[model samples]
Target chain A: MTVVGYRRPAPGINPDNNSSAYASTRARAPRHPAIRIEHTLSEITGPHFETGGASAIDLTRGARGEALGERIIVTGRVLDDDGRAIAGALIETWQANAAGRYAHESDQHDAPLDPNFAGAGRIISDSDGAYRLVTIKPGAYPWRNHPNAWRPQHIHFSVFGTGFAARLITQMYFPGDPLLAIDPIFQSVADPDARARLVAALQMDVTVAEYALGYRFDIVLRGRDATPPQE
Target chain B: MKTKLTSSQTVGPFFAPLLRGDLSQMVSAETRGERVVIEGRVLDGNGDPVPDAMIEIWQANAEGRYDHPEDMQEKRLDPAFHGFGRVGTNARGEFTIHTIVPGAVPAQSAQSQAIWQAPHLNLIVFARGLLTRLVTRIYFPGEIANDSDPVLCAVPAGRRATLIAKDIERLAADKAASRRLCFDIVLQGANETVFFDV
Candidate 1:
């Protein structure tokens, strides 16, 4: 593998492109070109916080309430381009409930909402840039972005790096979801390997004896491709 | 080896619960800086309100210092300022941000020697059907520094106005939100907001 310094890399399609057919972009958004700005200490430094306070990762357990669904443990490390762990980075996530229904009022989906599941959590990375979350496997939900369309089972992630420019927000899909093959949001990525980075791998060690299954998802904030080049 | 960065996905319409959290405020009453209210609507190509969108803002403190370790400059860090704010659009596709008027930051490169950025807010927009989050900046109207802002100068002359928020009115004597500004974001039509790559 080749090594590069901490300088932010050049533009890659996955980091820049937004499909035109993506209904929202086609709406009243900018068609103008974006100006590329170099990163500075201002864009490189992020907020610092204590390991724990109100920040918690378990979404399944709320105040005197428990969400109804199959439990799962999602754990991972936040690394830089060099695969070095970045401790204290903030990771926030929001997902739909087990019935494929969101808790927001805007969601007109026919599925019922689970009162106990708020489906949101935030946590600071450990010394190894490691984080663990307990949540239900969100179900696939239908949408009209396209005819007869349904989003695949996935969770939304928002990660804050040292600076404002380092912010990376994306979705995480399950390892074996048939819906992934046809999902437009997944297909918009264009690069197969880049798309694959969104899927978590099963980890037996993290699984609770009878409580939950374990999945590992390690995120590299910026770096040379960790995957072998496509032939 | 060629590493492809992971692509972005929509935050969707369900981020409301998280939006209601306390971190949504960029500056609180205890914050040491001039307070301002940024209000605006999110319109679609058809001039319709995008009621489900979410907006987030990040900026430096009033003293041109960031609340980060890398920004170890001499300016004092305002203990009350966090420099971050988030809000979801209301039914009218409008959102308001209560924040301090950020101070200017220095250019990121030596090539632009002695160049300092005008006070501005970096914004990120999220909504349903948006495959990716839209990034942009809101510059204060009538700021002289804007004329030389390296990033602002990069925009096509006629389109520069799209990035500057217009001053609506100065708040009355007894208010914390000392200034008010309006900046409507057109998602795709005539006056589309200028989105930045970074």
Candidate 2:
């Protein structure tokens, strides 16, 4: 869904036109100490699990993920504290399998799916800041919105910051999801300009593995600045 | 586990972090009324801003007491009560709340105690991953009971006013009776909340 920062601006009742003095007055204030938290990946303790993963979008695995599907992998790189490539962050992803069904019991999708395909996977970045997961393209599904509200193709990803509070939670959306326009949640973003920030662009196209297409999405986690504080 | 990383191992690209939830989600398009906007900056002891922290304020209606049943104080309640709100700070750790000035709550102490605290608002701060939260009370000036209030005295003497708000005597020449209380909270860095811990 598209979301803008604080959409629907309130009635701004300021007599002071957006003047330079007002801006400077606001900028001079100093910082609070509580915000200075940082973490790296190895510090996170949650165990990673993929649900309904490894099944083919081809759905030949039947309603149960018992059969072997074509093997395709997703690779990504991590960034370091200095905005460089981080070599060892763990990237985990969970999603509905090829049949658009999750290992979660709450999911009521009645498509034939492989029991082995748990619809989830994880990959740790290599030395070059690269990581990859083996899975198939997920299918769009209908939600309760309308009698038939459908969601666009997307993947939920988690990156363990390697340490304490640095963990990141986000979703990767394929560039061209036609459902974006009608989605109420995505349309709720107050700032249309900022809403564009959430969409991911596809690269490394052409051929991933002949039958498998490739869409590369890179993510960055929160980290400390390399610059020392000024006196 | 490879704990030690040589300089060569530190190759990673930098991208500014993305906050998971959106603050815009907090604002609703439907609501009709005059909403007062209280805005201010949060600073550390060294006067630095804290980003991504949340500030909360809870106060009774203008009458001076909370609506909860536990409260048995004598303060008239104004039906126009809209004092509870939360604001998430931006990258600079600035915040604002819009509410009316609360009336003084008559001290529930016995006549012999005769203690009354100034009319004030309560504040709490919650930061990501912080196991403990920060709590402080904002006080208004000209409070006859400031001297006898137990919590105000709990704070060290030298910094009593840090917890108090600056009172505005008048807004304009012929304006109705109105007052603005300005309280700037100094967090622990080199500085700490005047009377708050955890």
Candidate 3:
């Protein structure tokens, strides 16, 4: 049997591996140009994740108590380039606590870590390609990339779409974050429009009345051709 | 009409605690094929360990058939093999996987002719500094088919060695030893691993 491969990402949508502003990339970006190859069954087939495991969708509470911060609801749909819903996709998320400190041992930020907040969550997209997460607004934190460099408040996301080629690891920034202007990681994408797609928008309709604010962040993965290969 | 794709970001240092399961073991006692052990480290250009990196691998079953609908070939699918594994590098930047040597699979050229790909594992790397995930493949050394593999041939002759894993004797010396191999990844600078854009 023959398979039709997924489309390559549009130019200027992906970040350059050699972006100089991100100090770590200087030592990690490959110098050789990536070899473009035809996709095969290896690229079209990926592992399907089941929701029966210990996956959690809420990040607002822990075994001890509720996390402290402004409660918010984050929800969105996972779609392909043609805007078709991609159901059963796995979405994993992690972030710093409200005090701008991570629960990781490597985090050197002097802020306080919330004992009640592990700041991690995972969920599978529903049949409609929609997912929702309940969590607190993360605070901005400073990194050593540059003097006085503070990343905008954002949640890191790892998404596994339908195929191996559709895997994505990205950050979802909050709207109106002043740090977006100077954040090198956010600016790495050359296209202004493409960069803006990383920021989630405010949506009152998704907000839980008197409970939590709502934000919408839609994601688009690589799409396959409309036609399948002939036998 | 085309919609803009969402931009990528680093996987960050905090993801280790969130990866819920032990995906390092991809085989069971009932699984078929030659048992093999793949071990490696994730390193930076300066040769420092990247402990925060996560690696995911996908490959065919021992019969060279993927457990997906698209792989409609007539090969047998081992019920014990799911052809997937996910793990994070340790504090010392090391990782390991236990699986079998998959059989060669059939591919096609632009003209619909059959082409054979050598036994290999597809890998994806995600780390704290990489805004985008890196895609690569691991091919076993000494496979005669390596000479004609289309993907390997596409790479320049000088750098093809980066994609091949080295046979390590230390791992083979273990009690339950399988075929032990090592393949370290250099994210940049000299001897950087070959990354594919596909």
lDDT of 3 by residue, A75-158 (tens): 999888888888888888889999898898889999998999988888888887889999999999999999999999999888
Residue-level lDDT tens digits of model 2 in A1-231: 010111111222111111222222232222332221111111111122232332222222335444344444444556644455655565656666666655554467786556666655555566666665556666677666456777665566656443223344445556678977765334433345333434555445523646555556556543442321221
Q: Judged by lDDT against the true structure, how good is candidate 2?
A: 0.46
Kindly list the per-residue Cα lDDT of model 3 for residues B68-180, writing each as its tens digit.
77788898988899898998999899999888998888765666677889999999998878878899999998999999998999999999999999998754347476888
Cα lDDT, all candidates? 0.76, 0.46, 0.87
Please provide, for model 2 over B108-191, each residue's C-alpha lDDT reduced to its tens digit, 9 standing for 90 to 100.
343564454466666655443221235567776677767776667666686677776665445577254334445566654334
Stretches > 4 Å off in candidate 3? A51-56, A229-231, B110-113, B170-176
Residue B16 shift from truth in candidate 1, angstroms: 1.2
Residue B114, candidate 3: Cα error in Å is: 2.0
| Residue A164 lDDT, candidate 2, scale 0-100 | 24
What's the C-alpha lDDT at position A203 in model 3?
94
Question: Alpha carbon lDDT of residue B197, candidate 1?
Answer: 66
List, in order, the clash count of every candidate structure: 9, 58, 1
- Model 3 gets an lDDT of 0.87
Label model 2 with its docking quality class.
incorrect
Worst 10 residues of 3 chain B by lDDT: B168-177
